[model samples]
Target chain A: MQQITTEGNQERMQRLVAVRPRLISFARLQLRDLARAEDAVQEAIEAAIEKDDTFAGRSGYETWVFGILKYKILDSLRAQRREGWWQPLDEELDEAAIDRQFQKNGRWDQEARPSDWGDPETTLHSERFWKIFDLCMTALPDTAARVFSLRELMGLSTEDICRETGLKQNNCWVILHRARLRLRACIERDWLAEEA
Target chain B: MFKMMMCKEATHLMSKRLDVPLTFQEKLSLKVHLAMCSYCTQCNQQFSLLHETGKQYEKLIERDIVTLSSGSGDSR
Candidate 1:
């Protein structure tokens, strides 16, 4: 029995290792802040160490960690909210709309391609966009921002997010909806509206 | 069923949940709303375009990752 338990712990750790990178990715997207994401992931790893035996294998190990990650993200957001690190949603939207109205003017969907058009590799692997994306992500709040990253950026489903965040379907939907709208508005104001 | 399960207030709020594409139920309500509200229709279009552009941007990011990994950014 002791040997079986030891083996199980070993398996859980291995599973945790594989999921670590993806978990960090999810947290980063959710928090829109890499340091915050890393902190959340570390918290999740600590929690997983405590409950490794409870993993029933009903879902992938990565999925389970994501569930922990979701909680970490929500906790982070709540903490930030208490610290007054949020803008009113309407204020964010109005600012985006005004920026869009001003910057877009009349030209829609006319973004220029990268300067070095022919090099697919250069475009594909450039860190330029990621750096800018990291900066703009700070504009997003904690949980709402994370939901969009998990769903939109990382390609997790509503169901997965539901499992992670411990939210019912309706609540998950609400978070996702709010996250997407805010991020879309942020991108419109910060990035897209900059062009002709 | 989705239209029935989702209310009018919820419908407008949930419209932004389409990361993949609009579902039949979502489409049904969206079509109804878009017929009356041009701004929402524009918002939806803008969302999809943003997604497409984000894909383009991801590529650029990956290249930078490679550059950093190889220490190429240090000098020629």
Candidate 2:
């Protein structure tokens, strides 16, 4: 753990204050409740400040603080689940709707054909793409969005997600599959279609 | 005919690979489908792009923190 000198403590305090807004925004993306998001961020920052010595400086301060915030968000989610305030993701994807994307023999329909996306990493620098990306992410069903965020954004594994969200393995896989399908379609329609 | 997988099923396997390990037969089936079907291949590519975009977005968010902290520091 890194030693927090008096001067370092003051600097860290200011840095934490600056990062708080971003932390709250992240929490809001997961929690979907503004007041609850704020509360989670507040608790995370307080815990970090109180446990300043626990930061080993192996990671950047912001990264370390965000790690703390991730746990806080999970705690809040678990508490919400325990209190019966959490809603399961909508899993009843319409079979007809899904089948419509395929032909009688299961080949892809013409309309369902995905075009080759050449070097998608090129678009990451585009601010407009991120805006559309954010919209597509937020438009996902609440639980689906959280699952995607935890798995993709936070880089959590499937087992970790099941543990964190109290989801069964099969259910977790189904939710992620549906979420990916929706997100890919949404981006293609709202973002990629526009750029063409 | 029994061994043949549909595009829907292939897509499901493609997505599943991201979350869990597919059995040898499952992987072989998806591979065969991708080989014969341009559409599923493109779909797989699109999913890859989404995963790439997500990782890049996280880095972008991290960079934004430096930008935020370097500014007047009072801006929320």
Candidate 3:
């Protein structure tokens, strides 16, 4: 029994090392700082190793490890919030770009109107489409990308997002709106327009 | 002329709805606008699709992590 337990621990450690890159990428998406993301993933892996005995096999090992990493990422986010590590850059410029989509009458500009994306659902299954989507996500302005990821990708509530980003509730909503609009336009232009 | 919901406002409401519950007036105006505006209606569908894409993207990340870890043979 002791020998069996030792082998299990050894296997777990190997698995942890193998999963490190994936954890780093996941953290990078949320933290948006490579060093911080690497730090968070490292901390989580260390914690996982220390607490290996407590890990029940109820879920897949990767899922369980991800749960721990999620907390580490959130803690890093909270620390950044307390430190005022980032400020929304060129916010007025971003807002102005969004406004350009509409005319003085508040209707869409002829050139800015959303085009019909025939069967967007079908694109979800296309790996190339997701590659375009990732490019569009990366193209978002810094603050807008972070806020949108927290609210949409991470499934954080708007209030939690406002607290994390030190933005007011209305500002959070506006950023999310801008992210969606930009992402929509980017995907349309890069993916759909290219196809045509 | 009565103030009607413009496409800009309608699209904003559509995107905002994905994040939060809209107020009654906001919901009503959005509904009214979407009914008359085919463009806004299409925009609404795309907004929801975008939300779904976000969820799917998360799953994809998780799946990739699992595949990467398992696909790599034991490297001590």
Candidate 4:
């Protein structure tokens, strides 16, 4: 009937509006680029429009849409995997090639300004803070890096991260421990060296 | 040796709970360990810093959600 079709189109448009920003951030997290993330999310919205009926109301609408986006991410990664161009996050983190995080003999370089790194409590949003955080996070081992990002950056719980990552609970704790240690060291060598 | 590890683990777990005060036995063992190991001292500091940082970051990220959407729940 006309009523059902009208309702469907209206609801579909609303879902699009609801899921937009989250989809942008989700894809951005996976792809690490804003444009690519926007493209993937737009593509996902188009797909979700066609399959709206398949969304059985078993879970949240955003979660269901993200499931679709996960497929897109996997597809993108698979294409890269086939091309042999996709590098693991762990292997791709090159300390030497990257702007030289630490000065020679483990001293903190003073050029970037040491006083600013003092309070993570206040300087959390500072460019240098995020830059150092990202570098140190990438320095973590692959599984640990993924776990930390999922738990911290993506705001996933241990149970959710475990399910998505296929890691055991105890393994999750170990990964978290390693991430914390590596991040602490990274901050010490690169960010906090001046004070030390 | 295994029993000692188990006892130490249990005591550490007990220490982690906010509600439970360490018994005299655990308190004594902890004092002895802290007296001997600076690594534990560093770990305690790191754990406190990390916990506080995690709580604050979660709050900040929660606030970062875009709430100015024009559409309400009924907009669909």
Candidate 5:
């Protein structure tokens, strides 16, 4: 009986090791702080191992670990919100800046028009494109980046995003919209239109 | 005179639909603009592609981070 339990513990330890980095990635995407992300991943892993037998194996180990990490990330977001770690700029100012990309008549500015991406299926498959995409995401203001991740990556609804980020509903929508426009512009100038 | 939505407002409306349901007036005005303007249509397509790229990029970054950390065995 002792040997069986020891072997089970060993197997679970190995599984946790395999999933650790991914858990950390998910956490960092939300927390945006390495130390906090590491702490969350640590707590999540320990929690998972402690409750090992309770897992019904209904999902893969990674999925289960991510489910736990999600809450941990939310806790960090809430804590940071309470601490007032974020000082979001006036959202209207941000929107006004974005509005300049279009003319007064509501047409795309000459510089801001969306250029044809030429066969998006192939562009999506290109590793280079993904690298540029990541760079653009990182370039966004921290709050905008976080909001975008919550909405696009986490698939969180706007209401939930407002709750998590402590942002008003309109603010959340404005930030998300601005992030998309800026990200699109970055990719166009730095990657696509560069060769044009 | 026909009421025309500006390109900036139309694009904002485009993104707003994702966050909340548009009012009937909002939806009608955007539809009118999109019908006349091919540029806003391209902008809408670009937004969709950006969104799709973000979804795919999330998976790639997760796997890449995992491999980088696991190879070094440095979770800290």
Candidate 6:
């Protein structure tokens, strides 16, 4: 029985190490800070190892590990919000940029109009397309990216996002709108244009 | 003179609808604008596509992690 437990622990440690990079990627996307993401993933790994004996078999090991990391990421986000680390400095600038996409008559400016992306499902399947998608996500102003991820990737409602980030409802909507515009334009320029 | 909804407002409504339900009036205006303006119509579709892509990206990462970790000899 002792030998069996020792082998199980060894296997668990190996699995944890194997999944570390993906965990870091997930954390970085959510936290947007590499060092902090690394710290959270490390802490999660340590916790998983320490609690190996008590792990309930209800969930897959990877899912269980991700659950711990998600809490860690949330803790870091709460801490950042409390510290007021992200100011809304560039929000007006973003609004101005969005306005430029339209003409004086409120029609889409010829140069800024969104083009037909013909079969976006095909693009979703392309590995290279996702690379451009990741670049576009990274290019967003930090706060916009965070709000976008919380609303879309994390599946939080607008109200919850506003509560979490201390943003007003209107402000949250504006940020999400800008994020969608920028991502659409970026993908068109980088991926769709190349295909044509 | 019938006031036509501009692409700017139409696009904002498109993005906003993804996060929250649009009021009946907002939905009617958006429907009218989209029928008249093909550009905003396309943009609206792209917004929904982007939302789906974000969801798929999340799943992709989770799938990768699961596959990597499960490569070990542990059977579950």
- Native-referenced TM-scores of chain A, all candidate models: 0.52, 0.80, 0.79, 0.49, 0.77, 0.80
With candidate 3 superimposed using the best TM-score fit, by how many Å does residue A60's alpha carbon deviate from the native?
A: 4.8
> Could you tell me the TM-score of chain B in model 4?
0.45
Q: For model 6, report DockQ.
A: 0.58
Q: Predictions ranked by TM-score, top down?
A: 6, 2, 3, 5, 1, 4
The total of clashing pairs for model 4 equals 0
User: Please, what are the lDDT tens digits per residue for candidate 2 over residues A1-196?
Assistant: 5544675566677777876776776787778788989999999998888887777355677767777887888889888888878866546553455566778987878886677655666766777776777788788877888888888766789899888877787888888777777777777776667778
* Model 4 / residue B56 / CA error / Å: 5.9
- lDDT at residue A159 of model 1 (Cα atoms): 80
lDDT of each: 0.53, 0.76, 0.77, 0.52, 0.73, 0.79
For residues B1-76, write the lDDT of model 1, one tens digit per residue.
3333212233344445463355687667656665664445556554554344334534333333344435533332
lDDT of 2 by residue, B3-46 (tens): 78888888899889988889999999999989998888878987
In model 4, the runs with Cα more than 4 Å from the true position are A1-120, A194-196, B1-76
Name every residue pair that clashes in candidate 6.
none
Candidate 3, residues A6-102, lDDT tens digits: the string is: 6667777776776677567667777888899999999999888777788845556666777788789889988886788867542635877778878
Name every residue pair that clashes in candidate 5.
Answer: A106-B6, A106-B7
State interface RMSD in Å for all models. 10.4, 2.7, 2.9, 9.8, 4.0, 2.4
TM-score against truth, every candidate: 0.46, 0.82, 0.81, 0.44, 0.77, 0.83
Per-residue alpha-carbon lDDT of candidate 6 for residues A1-196, written as tens digits (9 for 90 to 100) = 3334576677667767777886787677778888988999999998888778778455566667777887788788887777876554336467766777889888998988888887877867677877787788888888888888888776778898877877898988988999888888887788767787
Docking quality level of the chain pair in candidate 2 = medium
Best by DockQ: 6
Which parts of model 2 have CA positions greater than 4 angstroms off? A1-5, A93-97, B52-54, B68-76
lDDT of 1 by residue, A1-196 (tens): 2335575466556556655665676566666667887899899987887777787555445556656766787788667556766432322233343233222432222331111122334433434544445555666655656555656655567787666555565665665555545554554454434432
Q: What tier of docking accuracy does candidate 6 attain?
A: medium
Q: Which ten residues in a row have the lowest lDDT in candidate 1 chain B?
A: B2-11
- What TM-score would chain B of candidate 1 score versus the native chain B? 0.45
Model 4 Cα lDDT, one tens digit per residue, B1-34: 3123222232243224212355787666666665
lDDT of 5 by residue, A54-128 (tens): 773454555566667777777877787789876544363556657768877767888888877767777777777
Q: Given candidate 4, what's the lDDT at residue B2?
A: 18
Error at A67, model 4, angstroms: 14
